[model samples]
Target: MVKVATYFAMTFGAFLFWQSMDRVHVWIALHQDEKKERMEREQEIKRMQAELMAQAKESES
Candidate 1:
């Protein structure tokens, strides 16, 4: 009876640990995706600014 109870407790602990690790992995992946999106947005904004500057220079000429 004692062995059975010990096994049950260990199994429950392992299950909880696995669940928490899964959440951590998901959170890391989401942050990485967000970072990638932010970089792309910054690049796009820079490109637009360059285009606007070119237009202004052309208008000055």
Candidate 2:
């Protein structure tokens, strides 16, 4: 009976560890995706600014 209880305890501990690791992986993935989106937005803003500058230069000419 004691051996069975020990095995059960070990299994439960391993299961919990695996679940925590899975959560950590998900969080990392979400963070990376957010970073990528932010970079893309910055690139878009830069492109728009360049276009506006070109338009202004043409008007001045």
lDDT of each: 1.00, 1.00
User: How far out, in Å, is residue 5 in model 1?
Assistant: 1.2
Q: Between which residue pairs do clashes occur in model 2?
A: none
Error of 1 at 59 (Å): 1.5
Worst 10 residues of 1 by lDDT: 1-10
- Model 2 clashing-pair count: 0
What is the TM-score of candidate 1?
0.89
Residues 1-61, candidate 1: write the lDDT tens digits: 9999999999999999999999999999999999999999999999999999999999999
Question: Clashes in each model (backbone N, CA, C under 3 Å)?
Answer: 0, 0
Model 1 deviation from native, Cα RMSD in Å: 1.0
How do all models score by TM-score? 0.89, 0.90
- Give the C-alpha lDDT of model 2: 1.00
